[model samples]
Target chain A: MNTVVRNEKYWLMAAGYIGAIFLWYASVKWLPISSFNRLPDPLSVIREWLSPDPSYGISIFTSDYYVHIWYSTYRAFTAFFLAVLLGVPLGIFMGWNAKFREFSGALVGLLRPIPPLAWVPLAILLFPGVEPAVIFVTFLVAFFATTMNTLVGVRSIDEDYFRAARCLGASRTDILRDVIVPGALPHIFTGLQIAMGAAWFSLVAGEMIAAQYGLGYVIWEAYNLIQYPTIVIGMATLGIVGFLSSAAIRWVGQRLMQWREESLGLGG
Target chain B: MEQVMKRDRGSNNSEGLAPRPEFGKLSIRNAGKTYDPQGSAVVAVHDCSIEIEAGDFVAIVGPSGCGKSTLMNVLAGFDNVTSGEVYLDDSLLASPRQAPSPGADRVVVFQNGALFPWKTVLENVTYGLLKTNAMSRASAEEKAKDFLSRCGGLDKVMRSYPAQLSSGMQRRVEIVRALVNEPRILLLDEPFRAMDTISKTTMHQHLLKMYSTCRRTIVFITHDLEEAIYLSDKVIVMTTRPGTVKLELTVPLPRPRTPEMTASVEYMDLKKEAIESVHEEAKKAFERGERELA
Candidate 1:
């Protein structure tokens, strides 16, 4: 009975969401005087999604919709993976030890205030290729935020914890691995979540400017062609990809630091 | 009862010695500490010296900022002294040069339990053993379980984090963590200050029982005269500011001290003397502050 009630509640929420979207569609259609044309009706967009190129003798599964999605998702994954590879270590180094903090902290601080898109010129000048540009922008977006938050987290750990570790005979390496890293993980995860969003935003911007094959490129291409349905489809795809990737980052964080959630009242 | 056992052991060991008497003594010879010469150069402790024998329970009592904590930190090799030296068992005491050895021989129980919030009670107790090669994981777990049982068996709350436990319970975990390694000298810094009266009494009894069984040298720092009197064999009275040892009073009270001893004439006299010493130091400290301001 409880599970049934929960399922009913879930359906209710879904209905409410769809109802809100329909309301938005009605307002946009009925309203007048705008440079951007009214968004295609929600049902028409859904129909386009379902039977995309039905007359082409191609399966719906192998349509442009899937291609667009695969391209967008692949780009996002690659950019995010590269961001993590660069960001996490830079963060850990800046956070875990004083010497690294002294050396790199000011430099990171100086670079962090500049928006990731501000580096577009530099990216173009240095590496004009589409992948390199996107990756560069993504790296710029993710690095500083992760480094700063990780530093805060490391600094916030109780001094007595270090003393206790030392008194118990922990080697410097052991302290870093067993204590410092775990202690700062929650903050590092938070930084990564923020970086994920930043990376996605920069990826889209980078793709819109220079990319040949990505969701942002498709959106711009559709806009020029005045294919409103395809444009909406591309926009929705970008939104969904960004949302899912962020949620996935949060999910990984929650799983790895499950104890922190229960104890620190975080990530619930 | 265990003091009697220790006395018997000491006597027997003393007789069997071939030539020289064994002196398990800790002597602090004219120790001094000054912080920040470019600043005010505050002397937390100066020219303070005391000697405690093995198996002795010595308490240092003084007013706030009298360097009681500083002295404790110095003894534990956590801080450097400006001058003078500390000798433990006739060897010069220095900061640890390598990973702490098994049975660290000097474990400190901080005022706050300072149990790692991320670790469970069992994990906290077994932390020191991680560096040791003597015990297998299973044996270490078994030993830790035994110590926890002595503390009060692990129930549902055993696996809970430090934040889940009460203040007194957290302190008990720290105490057990310190004792589990069987340290040679157990230094406690106001470990009972956070407890309620009932919990404090219970902890005092538990500590006494543990000391009696282990026969380890205990250096307890507190401001409470009654606590110092009740727990210590010798109470070292300290002056304020640039702290100096005023006097070392040996409590001749019989073993297994009871609460009634606090109301006894002898206990009252000793308590009065300790209070007077603190008051004098406090007054002098205030006057010195005034002169500095002027």
Candidate 2:
């Protein structure tokens, strides 16, 4: 009964989106709702995206769309990967050790609250290239999100687990491996999803200023050239990419933490 | 059939030849623990002491707020005594400078079992072996499987996580985990408190078998008077609040205590005595709390 309701719910959601698209297409194509008419019609955006570009002679099928996508993807992923690689261990270690927490916590505290976009000027000034600058700004956003969440993950573990490990003759390293890491994994995965979104968010913002080639750069460029349809294309691409990347992270998390999923019946 | 019997005999021989764990006698001398959480002070234990035989099954029963769990925490080395000392034979077990951390030699099977939720039954069982660096992974798995099978749960629960099993089954896995360490002393703090009567009885039987085979000193804490009388060789009753040993009654029932023994006169008498001691302490505890409130 619940599954049936859930299936109906998803169908309703899809219909809602379809209805929204219909409304937008109708409003722009027929109704001259002055303010809404100023925006590009979804149909024109779709056509321009699929058909050859007027200025560059490229479309969704061509390598041109992919090149912009690849630039954004590659930079965002590089930053996110570096964040996870550095952040998870650093977070876990800080969580486990008080001395380390006291030493590094001040710097983390000072930097983390600063908005991802706020660092754009600093990142641009520090790094020589546009690629490195954009990556740096996005990296800070994902890194802070991942690290803080991973730290909270470590702290949230039950005290029973630590005592049990000690009783079982676990050393510091053994407890970290067998208890802390696996215990905090569910939270780490959640952080990764959050971090992925933050990465894309700041990546787009970063590319608006820094990069030569990427979806964000294209959006800025299109806006400057007053290509309304192309602007919509860039935004739609960012939305799709962001949603897919977060979904991918969630999928990997579920796969690795199968025991949790099975217990909660989280899997389909 | 011959091959099976041959393997069994070989295992039996190996078990017999394995060095018996000879843990020193446990002694708690004038131990006291005072809690100073926030500004208020709560004295959980004060001048409480007891001597436990090397292989004896001892049960501590007391009123609520009597610090029974606190005492278990002290013995398990999870908490330090605020004053006095606990000793293993001639050596002091704890120090002011370094709080005594729990060792593999003293395994505690907590009330909740504390089985890692992420680990399978076999993995949880083999965890101690791996942590202690006692055996290679293959040997640990083989040995853990043997213990799990002996508990009659291997085939059904080997791959299951703690969440997938019943509370009773989780407790069995926990027991297997503790036994695998071959600990000298087993501390069970209300381990079967959450189980139904039938499950409790089953656990008591399993525990007895494990005790006889391992010959580890067992200190079990419980609120159930009948359980205390049924299981322990000596049952200690404690006073409430700033708890101290009130009474130590020796149960004279012979080895291999049966459920039928619950109906016996001796069992009833021992139960009556323990109940009487605990009731008085509980009344005192209530009065004490009332006085403080007033």
Candidate 3:
């Protein structure tokens, strides 16, 4: 019975995507709007994406397409990796210590509300080059997301766990390792998913504004050159890649948190 | 039954696994706790004093909001008293000036089941022993399995997380986790609250069996009078807000007590005494609530 429901859910999910694609195709082909005519139809975009030797240069078969994908993936991944490395520890300490939280919280409060796109000018000024600037701006958004989520994760842990740990003769280090880290992990992973999305968001914005070799650049370049299908291809690729990256984080989280997954019955 | 008998014999024969030294006499002298010291201070417990001898199972019973939990926190070293002192045998545990740190010697089986959900049942049980460096990893696992099996057969779910177990099983695991550490004093804050009747009964049997084998000091906190009478050597009733001991009743029931004892004349007499004392306090608390509403 459970498997039947799950299979039905999978079918529904597939139908949703297919329905959206059909709607896109219908709107572009049949709509009277001039904007719809200007926009490439879904069929043509898919054809251009799959073509071995495509018009207007970039396609799945072209080296330039992979180059754009690699650059965007590299930038987004580097920022995300750095964010997790720094943000997780900083978040742990922020939640753990009152004095440290007070000191760092002031800077975090000052910076957090500013949109990621707004950081482009300051990032360019702070870093020496476009590559560093784009990466820096992307890193900031993911860092705040990861750090804040991690801090909240640590705080969300029950006081009894701490009491139990201490009563069990756990040292400060042991408490941090055994209680704080594991307890906050669910939230940390939640933060990571958000951080990954934010990283992609800021990376694309940075790429469009400052950098020259990424999927964001491809979309902007295609727009300028009127390669309409390439723009759609860039967007579709970003959506798929962004989803895959977040899925990877979730996959790792599920592996590490088997106790939680099993309890949730996510395995079956 | 054969497994239980063999396990009992095994523990008796092992020198390393023998019961711990009896040094957990807890004495509280005029302990008081007032929350929010700076403004609008609310006294939770006032002039609460009790004496618990080593190897005695003492239960603190009171009406809801009677500061029973506040007193337990002081004994557990989670909070300190605003006045007076709490002593464990010779050493000071808590006071107005001296803050106490929770240690392996005083393990708490929290009412909400504090078994680390991330850890397997075996890991949770072995945690204290590992943390205190009381046993090597191999021996800790061995000892944990031994206690798990003894606690009504928890050995089968050794690899499972706390979330996978029933409330009764989780409660048993928590108790065994505390017992495995060989703490001088085992503090249970309404450890079996909210369990179904059948599970609660089974738990009582397991707890009594463990108590008989180990004979460690236990401080149980509950609002259930009958539970107080059945499980404890002495029941201390606390009055409502700014709570203090209203009455202390001793139970001279024989060891290895059975559920049948709850129906006996002596048990009923003791339960009657506890109920009257608690009812009087509950009436006062209800009146206070009504007055506040007014």
Q: Candidate 1, what DockQ?
A: 0.33
TM-score of model 1 (CA atoms) = 0.85
Residue B135 of model 3 has an lDDT of 78
Of candidate 3 chain A, the 10-residue stretch with the lowest lDDT total is A259-268
lDDT per residue (tens digit) for residues B175-214 in model 3: 9999998888999999889887888888888888888776
iRMSD in angstroms, per model? 2.7, 1.0, 0.6
Clashes of each: 1, 0, 0
Q: State model 3's lDDT.
A: 0.90
- Candidate 2 lDDT over A26-112, as tens digits, reads 898788678778778887778888885455333587786899999999999999999999999999988999899889999999989
What is the C-alpha lDDT profile of model 1 across A1-268, one tens digit per residue? 9799999999999999989887867766766746423667777666665663632222235456567567667766676677667777777777676798889878877888898788887888899576787678777777666777777878887777776676676777877876788788888888888887887787778778877777777777777776666666777777887889889988888787756676775533
Name the candidate, 1 or 2, with the larger DockQ value: 2
Which candidate, 2 or 3, would have the higher lDDT against the true structure? 3
Scoring model 3 with DockQ, what do you get?
0.81
In model 3 chain B, the worst 10-residue window by lDDT is B9-18
Provide per-model DockQ scores.
Answer: 0.33, 0.59, 0.81
Clashing pairs in 1: B105-B184
Clashing pairs in 3: none
| Model 1 misplaced stretches (Cα beyond 4 Å) | A1-23, A32-37, A52-63, A264-268, B1-24, B37-40, B95-103, B154-158, B258-261, B283-294
